[model samples]
Target: MPHYFDTAHRQEIETLRQRWTARTEWPTWLLLIGVYAGWFGLVLASDRLGLWWSTVLLIPLVVLWLSVQHELLHGHPTRWLRLNKMLGYAPFAVWYPYTLYRDSHLQHHRDEDLTIPGRDPESRYLTAERWRGSSLWVRGLHWLNKTVIGRFLLGAPLALAALANEERLKMTAGDRHAWRMWLTHGALTLLMLTFIARYSVLPVWHYLLLISVPALSIAMIRSYYEHRPRAAPEQRSVLNEAAWPWRWLFLNLNFHLVHHDLPGLAWYDLPHAYQARREQWLARSGGFLVQGYGQLWRRNGIKAIDSPRHPFH
Candidate 1:
């Protein structure tokens, strides 16, 4: 629970928090309204837009909805957890449940466990032993998952499969919590899909395949290199100076290290905090910085960024 920021930097963050107390979090509020309005508006207008065009437009809004969900889980735009959950609980993205994501992401914030297989729920790496023990086909899939195009195409399905397998095991072991969560998620997802089927021009399968899956893929871009195996925990996260488009879509999470350091800071405040002490943050992270996502794509287009095996393991 300790912050990575030094005393003075902590004081500066505290000052920002004080400023937040004096006024409303209008940006986060607007983001909540805007993402919902945009998504619903587009869905309602899909008949005129055609399937492909509507799918293309819907992808960004869905991605933004995921981002807004992230913000809500982080206690944004509201102080009450129940209110926040109510705002984000609709299964618009049509995959993971809000409660599941909330729990997993909070666990992922345990920085010291980051990038470690079995510990960090969001880790992309496997333990060295696990990698060594895998079948060739399994290893090949991991390799494909390392590339940009492959991650875009394979990331969502792979992640979903893994989550399903894990939850299956948990349910088999009589984990009632997991069962309850999935049942609730299933009911809500069915309701949302039903609404889309009745109201939208896009068919249910088309929306799932084109809009929902691709939205998850586009969202995965922010996380593609968000963390890496490193001896120092603070150095594991990357500071991606991504372009404005990505920043807006990911809710400024490209400043991943900053988010890890000050997890309580609002998404809108992240850029200012990082820019304020950019040098110190870079030093603290041991220079784990990417110029931008475009650079990431060009550099790791086909090649793996690094071994998928966790070096520390």
Candidate 2:
């Protein structure tokens, strides 16, 4: 990370950093606090409003909260690591811990290994040997997972299970750090659930099924095609330019290739930075671009966009 930027880009980034301040991040902190309070308030009133209606309304807020969690993990909105973790403590998303997420995501930013199947935790592609050894049913599921619809419906739950299983194995092998992370995450999750049970009109199971699942599914839309297998590693990340509502919900992550190129850049500044260097970014990514999520769904919602197995594998 010390050499994250070359000479020219380094100067531009240094100038940008000068303008960033703790005060600049107040809006983000305010939004996080407001959304969490609002979401919990809605749940508390679910009996009167109806559980289905409440869950439906909560989906977007949960997505926004998790997006902000991503920003916090990257050391935004505040310089203090302790304050950042405190901001990220709520387990509204439920399954993942901020500690584990921060570690894994930082590992994911190792540009040289960006989308390599076995190397990247966030990669959707299966390595060749694994694909070759899989039963037809397993292969079919992987193929379906490549499509927008399948990803929307199945990705989140499957990803949760996979991640949990990975952590289970690590803990079993005596990874004390992994053990501590999961233990702390479990305690916080139980604490959140106990509060929900105490006050929410909807049953805890109903809340988990109705709200958590759908929120995670919505996030899958952002992750579904963020990267692709490519001959050139740098070109693997995609630039998907979405308009207003979706862009705002994803916190301007549609300019994903730009984010990958400069992982330390603040979320709000992404759009401006991307616009200023639009042509350069497009060129750097070898033209891996899209208009929006709509384009992806239209093109690959049913059919697989790429094979489940990595092409090189």
Candidate 3:
């Protein structure tokens, strides 16, 4: 790996960094078109060729849409928040509320904020206490959350339950936008369901699996080898160079350390920037997953789960 995550400011990168830039909405617009095109095309193709055949194309394309949405919401495809949200708000995901995602992901960027369990909505890591307190069923669920199959099968329901619990807590605290986000997302979710009910010949549940499940599965890959929470915060990061497929497919997200180093860095620049400081990132993460993502699977086992911390706060 040529790139690394650098904390000290660099003169070279400073010149390229944008404090603010004109928003570009085209990439998201193109992606939205692409997603629907994939859905309708797969629907037609499935009728002619059957789902197994369509899965070859369907799975990858759906993955692409989800990744693009991740970037768009992160201020990659645009500078303006509204424009950014407009492009990636595919109610089709049927899992994440885009507003909630934007809020949680932004929180994820705070330096003190990485993988704080309950505090960080996106963390999959478990705190030592949480790990110890688990019952047999929960332990099994945690194991499943770490794998592809578990993510596809149980990810959405588990995620929805978590998000709902969080939202109720927020509502009690009088979070101003709670109702609005719900109503807005509620509309989008309805549209997603309607699209399925009218067009997809498969059960509506099947459409959820085809799109929402895979979206979560891909998310698991991004976080899977990204962190391990050693006693030292600096050593907590991990890398996955064998993740070339997902990195490209996910707009360079597999370069997890770089994102952590300078999160404000836009998606387009993460690759070259990561390469530029690869050695430092490796040192920072205690030699990163430089060994490869295979280590994650071989040692961790397929069904693995961990939260960043317990008691979230």
User: Considering every candidate listed, which one attains the maximal lDDT?
Assistant: 1
> What tens-digit string does per-residue lDDT give for candidate 2 at 51-89?
678877888888988898888888888878889998888
**What's model 1's lDDT at 296?**
81
Candidate 2 lDDT for residue 103: 81
C-alpha local distance difference test of each model? 0.88, 0.83, 0.65
Q: Which regions of candidate 1 are displaced past 4 Å? A: 1-7, 20-23
**What TM-score does candidate 3 get on C-alpha atoms?**
0.78
Preferred candidate (TM-score higher): 2 or 3: 2
Per-residue alpha-carbon lDDT of candidate 3 for residues 186-291, written as tens digits (9 for 90 to 100): 8987876776567655556766776567666665555655655555555656566756666666667777777776665666577667677677667777875545
Which one wins by TM-score: 1 or 3? Answer: 1
Cα RMSD, model 2: 2.1
